[model samples]
Every structure is written in structure tokens, then in C-alpha cells.
Target chain A: MSPDEVHYPGAVPPARTRFVRSLGLRLHVCEWGDPDGEPVLLTHGFYDHARSFDLLAPLLAERYRVVAMDARGHGDSDRPDAYAWFPGLIDVVNMLRDLGRPAHVVGHSWGGGQATDAATLHPGSVRKLVNMDGFGPPEEGFHVPGRDRDERPAPGQLAGWLDWRVANHSRETFRPCATLEELAERRRQQNPRLSSEWLRYFAAHGSYHTPEGWVWKVDPMAARNIGPFRPEWIAPGWARLRAPMLALVGSEPDTWGPLPEPMLARRLSHVPKVERGVIPGAGHFMHIEQPEAVARIVLDWLEAG
Target chain B: MTRLRDGRAELALHELGSGAGPTLLCLHALYGAGSDFRDLAAAWPGRVLALDFPGHGHSPRSFGGSYTPENLVANADVALAHASEAQLVGAGLGAYVALLLAGARPDRIGGALLLPGRGLAGGGAEPKRAEPEGMSHARFDVLLQGITADADPDPMLENCDRDIRPPDYARAHADSARLLLLAEDDAERPPWWHAVREADCAEVAPADPEAALARLAAS
Candidate 1:
């Protein structure tokens, strides 16, 4: 959030920061729990920055080392903004290599898949996997059928949005929450974490703030294209996954319904050590809707080991 | 008297396909109609009931209540009466109604595909999204322009009384999905991320047209 931005639930102070070096991109992270405790890493989903997990991080941090990261194109991480996939996964793998020890991994939705693959992509960096809802099989064209795709959000629209973000936000959009407590509160209300930020970011970054409010950050004319990505061919890449896994899905899947057969086949095909289940009363946004259930599920799994 | 006032108002209706298959009832996003999700119907199972939302396409004029959630759901309730059962699929505005309907009468809707849509905390009298202080009105107006410039805003905004919106076009407004998505992403294990956390973005994506809507009938 841009500094001085007061939000609901209540006001949250920001936090002090620290980071690590590895991969081409910088790793922006926040920590909780005892540094000396067991290292348990938490990764956010697409467009979500790491702090959104503040609420859940500490709960688990009490017993373990909790580290949450913001994925690229999201949060404070380098916005490569390039049209790429698994390639980013490799970077995380390399970052883990720097950690020197295979870390227990958890990922929700997109992050789940990344964690699942990171175990396979790097092999040595991950020990156990709490795949969350990310355990669904790779999209048929996991990375979209067309390699040379350009489905980037409308650059003009994006620019207009950016225009708004730049004008509204100062340097603080890059800053972490004022304090862990505040970050946790923000996380409780802000869920998936990106939409709220992006709306502001887009308003801040996509538009120009004049005397009134803000506008789109991009030109609003930035062209965008869609694709039919194919992930089946890329299935072989995930074959080396070594992490014992858990596939957590919402009680109600959107349209895909209960794990499509093919997707399920892909998950277990290579990583024979995979567990699948659901969070009661949770929908697509299971963790946000039922974080306790999710946390309990994660904690239980960790205790099992 | 022939009980003229008793009727909800005259409505045209149609039901296609009698085959035994899953049933899908698709609702369009703001400025869209049920037909918009039609493409998803082909790949899905059973029959499909696509209808125009109350104010758009061939649907009736906004009665006493216009574009609010209540009205949207009511329009859908009437539309769904044409079928025995259906998996509900809604996009954008339609998705909001779908969720409301699903919650209100879960039995009526087998399942739902609420594509990137507006949740409870969406566009209204108050700007749900936080914009740069001064330019929100203009920026919002332009957004209204962008949405309505392509479609129709008079009825759109008229039926729905919200200042930030022009009543002309559709806007991406939803609070739950945004938070849900964030919460959804945070479930990763042994977790520690390096990217920005707790960002205050307000815009959300339109729900997947077919992925959510199409699946309701297919399954």
C-alpha cells in the first residue's frame, strides 16, 4: 500500500524489511516465527504479494519458520511482465538452491502448482509439499498452446491504470505493511491480495491523478490477445517432483468441477506421493474463505511428519 | 378485472433441446445477456437456458427496482423457471446474481461458474475501489465511458443508481473474489515469498465465461 493509505477493519502500521539474493530477480520476503524453528515457507498465488498471508503466517510461525514470498508480476518482485511460465519456476528453484536446505513448501492455486513443480524443477530444494488448491493437473497446454503469445492486458488500459498508480502511490506501494499485526488485518480483508492492490496500483500506475481522483495507469488502448495454451506436452517437465504433496481444493470448483480426470492423472503420474482433499464450505477462494480449515489442514500435515 | 396487475409483466420465453444431459443456465456480465455464455454451452452437457438480463437485450424494462442485485436475481429467478434444473453459469454482473441466487436458493442452482465478477463490495454509491484521491471521479467517468462507449449506459446506469458508474457501461467491481483470490494464493506451504504483500488494489477480472458458466451444464 502507498504510505498514508488508511484502510478498513482498522489501520495497520508497516514493517521493517530484509531480502535475499539469487536467481535473476530479487526475492522480497517477510518472516515470522522463530528463525531457529523449522523453516516453513509460504508462497502466494498469482498477482498476490506475500504480506496478504500475514494473518495465517504467524499462526503457523509460532511453531515453525514462516517465510512468505510474492510471485513475479505481483507484489514487490521484479515485474518481468514478460509472457513466460515454468521459466519463473526455475528462478524460484535457483533461489531455493541458495537457501542451501530443502524447504518444506506450500502453495495455493498457482503457487501450489509452482511449489509442486519447484520440487521437481530443482529436486534438491524441496522436501515436503502442501500443494493446496494448486495441485490440480496442469492445464492441457499448461503454458498455453501457442509459445509466441501476446495476451498481455491492454497496454493502453494497463498504462492508464499505471498512470493512476504512479500518481497516487509514492514509494510505499513497495513498502511492506507497517507491522505484522496490521499486515495480518489487511490480509484478512484483502484475500487473493492483488485485486485490491492492483485496482489502486492500476489507478495509481494506470492513470494520472489530477485534482479529483485517479485514472487508468495504462493507455487503455494497450492491445491484448487470448490463447489456447497446451500443458500436456510439458507434462514430462513436472515428472521429477520429489515433494510429498497434498492437493487442497475448494468444496465447490468453478466449472472444472471435481478434479478433472486428466488433471488428477497428471498430478499423480509423476509425483506418486500426492494427497488430495478439500476444505469444507470453501469455494475457489478456500484459504481466504476458510483459512482456519486450511491452516488446520496444513498444521496437521506438518505434525504428521 | 382480468388481474392485469398480478402478472409480473409479459415475458417472452424459449427452451431449446430435449435431450437428456446436464442443464446449464448462463447469465451475462454487466451489459451482457445470457446468450454471451452460449459458446460454453456447446462443450457442456445437457440443455442451456440463456436469457437477457432485465434491462439489456430483449429483456423487459427495469420495473420498480432496476439494476441492483435484487433485481438481477429476480430476473434470473423468472428465467430459471423455464427449466427443471440447471447448473448456473454467470459472468460479470450475471455472476454476482448467480452467487446471490446460489446462496439464496442453492437447490435451484446445481453449481455456479461465477466468472471474474463483482462481489458484495463492488461499484456503487461509494467507490469500493480506492483511487488516487483527486482523479477518481474523472477516472471513473472515463471508465464509464470505456464501458458504455462500447455498449449502452443510459439504461445500464439508469437502472442502477451509482455515481461512480455512468449507468452506461460495466465496471469490474467485487470485494470477496479479490480477497478470496489473495487468500487462495497464500495457502502455499513451508512458505515465504519475496514479492509485495498486502497491496491495496481494487480492480478484479471478469469471471471465466465458459470455464465457470459452461461447466455448470456440462457436469
Candidate 2:
């Protein structure tokens, strides 16, 4: 089916799309709101494109100029030869550079972590920080906090990741979905809390049509695992952040994140100035599920002293 | 230079000399390319193959500085697949990979000759403050000087920028057929250098380059 045939009932289209070059790759940046207004950068989570913020961006755009980027290897951005955590943060910095001024930054899921690190690493580039459930998984392997020595990964575990990369690289092409609904169903499997209508909207923007079928626009190789990363390592940087942070997560449980309260509290304790909130009756994708509510919270926070 | 693929990774492999002896696979250090071994390959009596790891030389860069040790080893394995009987000769990061391959593919790798340089001791599992805020044009140019000649400095810089877990050297030790060679008077040897048995190490001496390498290859 043609792309025009796909539709989202109440979605608001981006006002303009701009491309910014960073590290030799051209990144697609979607814009909304008045050009003269203060900029608010929106970053989406993993497996999501800039358009994932279609509902939220418009609401925030009411008072601020919103720029949402399709991070490298996602949406219309150029795919890099590899995807490492540092480069993603660099992309955020470059986007701020393009804005030519410090802007309030809002990131969801993986983007939230990028926003946090970007603010910490390059303080002057961001005025305020808002992160939505971007903290990594709460499991021991990923979030082990105070260990004296750096532990080596089991040889088998390392080998298994390498083997997986090798096998993933061997695939001739991405798996094809017969229809857009099929794509939405796949996303629903991971995000069952989201309504089917919203998943369809997400899938439409996140994928493109091919002669064979529809496939996600994201680079399959972007999913390749990096060497060991622990959340505890991010604590030092969090403690150094100059901008006040607002951490938000949905009250409802979902498949991926919104780490447990005690663990979340411990991680948040590292930040110097942080305000925490739980979006009631929402899951990981709170903005999509309740845009008006999230917007009210975000707008009030940004407008405050 | 020949291009070979292991999964989606494209590697540039350079070959020199041909004889009945086992093929010597030369791996270069971080930012160094396969051509760095051209002089040695010409000197060796047996066949010699040098490979440009991904993001360096002719091989395509993996985006986002994905130069983790596992990724490097996996890409290097593609070159290993080409040789029927091979011995690994590596310096710096190359040496670390050689030690890993020696452990991972004992059947394919008969022995490994490890030399010292950057990446000799793998970045500890969690590297502290590994990321540079951003690289300026002048700063990048300064880094390129004397560090890399034939490859792009970006990937090399990316490779150097992360905290990577060291490979299980114990796995490499299981082979017991490898040697770690160091300079006689070198003072900055890795802390783990002494842990390698004395019998498995050779101190470089004033001798013919070919004879020394051939002697090392034979063990």
C-alpha cells in the first residue's frame, strides 16, 4: 500500500523538517511551534523516530519552538557504521549546536539517558532537563551499584554476543511485514499497554513501504550490543549536572521500564536537584497515552523558577 | 588488498609472500591499518596476511564508535577463516585480539605472538571517564600525527574512547602455545606482563628482524 494510505486519526504533522550534519552524517530534525520562541528539543526512545512525539510536540509547541530529531540509524537520519552510547550523546550536542542557543531538552526512554548525559557532559547546551523513564533496566547485570573491582564478563557471554552480531550481520534483509497492521501488532507485543490505534500510528511513522512489504526504518545493526555498561557509572556524571532535572515515569507497569521505586530512588539520589513525578493511569509511553496531562505537567515545570 | 565479509562487516585483507609454512596473520594496533605490516609481510618466508579492522583503512566504519573488543575480534575472525593454518602476530590492540583468538579458536590458531602497545591491557570492564566531551578539528589533527597514517582517525579515536571489558586472558592461557614479546629495556610494560610465563616471552634483541620473527613463529 502507498504511504499516503496510512493514517493516524488525531496526529499533528510537523511544521518543518531540517537536516543537521554531525560526525559526517546528516540527521533529520522535525520542527513545530513558532520559530522565534525558545527551543524545546524532544528526543524519542529506542526503536522510535522523532515523529513518535507528534502528539506531545504540538502541545509543548504552544509556548516553545520544538525540535525533535530522528537520531542516527532511526527515521530519515543517516545510519552510522556503528552505534555506541557516546556518539548518540554527541548527536544531542550537535543538535543543540544547530539551535545556536541553550534550550530546554526533553527525552523519553533511551533519549532520556542521552539528554541526561548531554546536559552533564556539555552543561551550557541545555537549560533544563526532563527525562521519561530513560533509566536502564533494574536487573543486577545492568544496574549493579557499588562494586570495588571491575568484573570480567564470562567468556561464554561475550562469545554469545559476538555470535549474535555475526548472525545478525549475515541476514540478507529485514523481516518484512505483510501490512501496516502486522507491524503495529509486533510493536504491541512489546508495548501492550498502548492502544491498537496508537500502535498503528507509531508503526506507520516508524516504517516505510518496500516492494516486498513494510519494514522498520531503523538499522538492524544499531541493535548490536556494546561491552558491559552499568548504571552506576552514570552516577558520577548525574551528580555533576548543572541543570535542574525533572524525572517522570508512568505509574502503570509495562514490559520495558520505569524501574522499581527503591532502585529508582537510589539512582535519583545521585542528582543534585531533581523533582520526581508519576504520570497516573499511564504506561511507559505516557505522552502518547495522555498528551494533555503530560503537557500540563511539563509546561508548568518549564515555566516555573 | 582483498575485501572479505563476516556477516555485515567488510574487512580489507592484504596478502604477501607464499611458501609451504603456515600463514602468518599480522594484526595492527588501534588506528594502525593492515598496510602497517607491509614491511614485515615482505620479509617473512611464509605467506603473510594483514587485515584492516572495521572503521580503519579500507573497511567501512561501524557507526557510533562501536569498536568494542568483541566486535574487533569478530571482524578479525573473518580473516582467520581465510587461512587453513595460521599463526597470529599482533601488536597493541592487535596483540589483545590475537590472545583472544588464540583462546576462542585454538583449532584454527596454532600460536600467537603478542607485542606491547596501546590496548595491550584491555580497557577494564568499566572504563572511568572514557568519553571526551567533543573533539575539535585541531585536536583531531594533532591526534592523527604519528598515531595513524593510512586510516581515518575518527574510528581509531572512537576505539580509544570507550571502557571495554578485558578478554578472559585465562581462556588465552589455556592454549599454552602463545608468547608475549617485549623490548629488553622497556619500562612501561603492562602489570600482567610478568604473569605470562618466562618461557612464553621473548625480549627483543639486536638481531635480524626476519630471523627473530621466524624464531618466534616456530615456537
Candidate 3:
């Protein structure tokens, strides 16, 4: 019952509930507040947890059934040593359907992508859709449109960067001391390599060691998995999603970089009824970095309708 | 590799490094997943394994079940099946579970170290009425400023959300009550009290300090 129970990723309070999800797998889901309340399915970022919605879930759960699920292989959910993209989408859809009532879908990253998938795949299943930093599909032909203008490497060219990333970022890997203020103070000193806003995500998601230092709980494999996701697989999925969406982009490009705003609009233009454009000051993983800002956007969108 | 033993819920473990070096199996503090102890394991160059306690880390949720001391110890037993023998080290709140492992089953632990740990089963649960109220912002602000490296308050204070820490502390006290499973706490107590007094069963060392405890542990 205490906030500590569901220790999902980041700064959110741990999750607490009997059955958050049941997709044949013992899905460890987190539901807050009353059962009969207005339900909202909270989808978190990759490597992040249900608690990432900590600040806002409590506020929302006060009136709605704020349900946060730890996607399979990420948090407390079973990491069955196997992964599949499409079946995973249905798992989320069925899990929400299992909620005993319809729910608004709010997803971030993979979850955001899945929320949109769930909405378009089963449009009636979701109410409001809040897609934070989740605009994908590449607009066609494996080309990230105008990226050549910047002269940056290809979108998925990640191999050469990992060792460089691990060696350098490991020390800078966000490990906010158990001290929040101290954790925040450390935030000011966030490595220049990462965005200031993205630095906040490090603060919210990192854990501590009694003697050594703070540790980021993300499996190193987390970011690496993306390199292999073929564009062919990514593009087809976009054709299935048409939910009303919000494209949130973090301010810092080097760190919170998203699909170029033009690229985002290009890909999302298919949705027909899109409430488009990006929110200010958010990065890829916006919630932990700026819970208030992220929550405000979701809340405002929820109220608009 | 960490395997979630079939049929045993929340009983999972990961083992790393092997050879002459003794294995070290670690359990993270409550509300913390098992991976929380990865840093502590890094402190020791020897082989190590960190297990997620049932319900907290990679393990299954307790589901109306409690993470009681006995349940925790049982989870430890199942998780450490790979490390039949090894030195054990527990940090912060995790030390309490280590105490139980060492005291209840001494033959398994080559050595045990508990840091910043109070008795696992002491002063029964803080009575409901006695819990302290929210910290004043001024006090919280001052407390925030006071955290330092050597006297680092983050891990110790942020051991977890306050609600879970006490019961976690209670579990540690339970181990203390078992004489063979207990050890010195004062700045003066021997470092390996359980080994000397309970294991080898000898009057080997004085609780004065490290050198003494090392000598005592050696004897």
C-alpha cells in the first residue's frame, strides 16, 4: 500500500495491485486508487517503469483508475528471454481490455507507439491518446527525411557509438544520490553531452549503492535493441495507427533528439484527425525529466475534449 | 546467469565469475530490485551473484503474501543454489538478510559483512502511533544540505520510501535474536562476531576494531 511497494523504474513510487496485466504471462501491472473510477492506461518509456508516472498518477488516480503496466521484459514483468513486436502490441491491447472497462491510452516511447497501435487496431478500446515523444515510421524508404542536411550519421548507426557511449557515459550515467535535492543539484552538473532536460530523466530513473555510487537500472541491452529494428517492420505498423496523437519532442537535440519536427509531421500526417505538433522542453523520456510538464500536457489534452 | 526457479515464486538469482575466488551472493534492500547491489558486488574483486528477493526485483510478486523475514530467507536459499559456498556481503538494509543467511546457516558463508545495519529483529515494529510526521521543509532543506560523501545520507536515508524501511529493519532484528546469527554493532564490536562466536565457537577476538576482528576471524 505504501509508495515503496511497486519499485518500477525511475522516481515514481512503486506500483501496487493484484493483477496489472495477464497476457498468459503473469503480467505485473500497477493500478492506483479505486476500481470503479474512470480508467486510464499509462504506458511508460522503454527501460522506465510504471512509477515514472508517479507525480501525475497519484493526482489522476485520485479520480481515475490510473493503471501503469511494466511492459514485458522491462520492469517486474517476466523477461521470458524472448521478444516479438506485434504480439507484444496485442498483449497490451488485451491487457487493457482485461481492465474490465475502457480506458484512455497514454503511452511513452514503445508504450506510446503501442498505445497508438492499440487505438488504431482497436479504435473503440481507447478514449484519449497522449503520445509523448513517440512519432515513428520514418516517412518511407528507411530515410529519416532531411537528416542528411545535418550530416549526422544514419538514424540507426549505433554500433560505433555504443562503446564510445558506455565508456564515457558510464561515469556520467545518471545516479542521483538518495538525496533528492542533492540529486537535483547533481542535475545542474549533468554532463554537457546530455541535454539538461534529459539529465532529469537520469535523476528520476537512477538507483544507489551504499558504498560505490548511483546505478542506472536500465539493462545495457535496452538502447542497443533498437539498432536491429528494420525499417520495413517499423513503417507497416504506422499504417495501422490513426488515434488522435500528441507529438512531444524534448528541447535538447544532442540528447532528447526526436524525429525532426518536419519528419514527425511527415510521418504523422496520415492520422487524418491529428491534434499535432510538439510540446516544449521535453526529451525522449519526458515524464521523469519533467513530470509536471508532461503531466500538464496530458491533462490539458484530456480536458480539451 | 539469473534464473527464476520454476514453481518457486520470486525466487531468482544471477551468478557471475567463478574459479578460486569465493562467490558472493547479494540481496538488495526492500523496495529495491536485486540489481541494486551491483555496485556493492563491484567493490569486491572476487566472483559474485546478486539475487532479486521474491517480489522486489526480478522475482514474482508476493500477491497478498508478505515479504517477511522467513520468506526472504527462503527466497535467499532458493536463489543461492548456485553458490553452495561463498563469502556473503550485504549493504545498508540488505545486510539484515545476509545476517540471517550467515547466522541461520553458517556453513554456507565463508565470511559476512553488514554495513550501516541495525539489528534485523529489534525493538519490535515501531508501534503504529509512534511514527514521526512529515519533515518540516526547513528541516528537510537542512537535511538535504547535510548529505556528504563519507557520511552519505542518500542510500541510508533513501534506503527506500520510509514505510518499507522499518519492516525491513524488523526483519534484520529477527536475525539478531538468533545468537549464532548475530554480530557486533558498536564501533567497538568485532567485525565477524557470528563467525568467531557462533561458527568456530571460540573466544577469538575482542570487539575493539578491525585488526582485532581480522585476527579474531583468523583464529
Quick one: best TM-score, which candidate? 2
Write model 2 residue lDDT over A1-305, tens digit each, in one string: 55555566657879999899766678999999999899999999988999999899999999999999998889999876656777677788879878989999999998999999888767778899999988766756432223232243444444555566657776433778999899889777778788898888788878887788888888887765554465666555587787899999999987667888898888888788999888999988998988888999999999999
Measured against the true two-chain complex, the DockQ scores of the candidates, in the order shown, are: 0.01, 0.30, 0.01
Residue B178, model 3, lDDT: 25
Q: Candidate 3 chain A, which ten residues in sequence have the lowest lDDT sum?
A: A150-159
User: Can you write out model 3's per-residue Cα lDDT over B1-219, one digit (the tens) per residue?
Assistant: 566552224356766444344576776665565576555555455567787764455665533222344335545655554567655555544665665555445445555655434333222333222323322335433432442221222222232222222333333333333222233465543223332344333233234434432432332
* Alpha-carbon lDDT of model 1: 0.48
Rank all candidate structures by their TM-score, best first, as comma-separated numbers: 2, 3, 1
* TM-score for each model: 0.42, 0.84, 0.44
* TM-score, B chain alone, candidates in order: 0.56, 0.75, 0.55
Model 2 error, position B200 (Å)? 12
Q: What is residue A99's positional error in candidate 1, in angstroms?
A: 3.3
Ranking 1 against 2 by DockQ, winner: 2
Residue B54, candidate 1: Cα error in Å is 54
Per-residue lDDT value at A296 in model 3: 71
Give the winner by lDDT: 2
Tell me how candidate 2 scores on lDDT. 0.74
Ten-residue segment with the worst summed lDDT in candidate 1 chain A?
Answer: A219-228
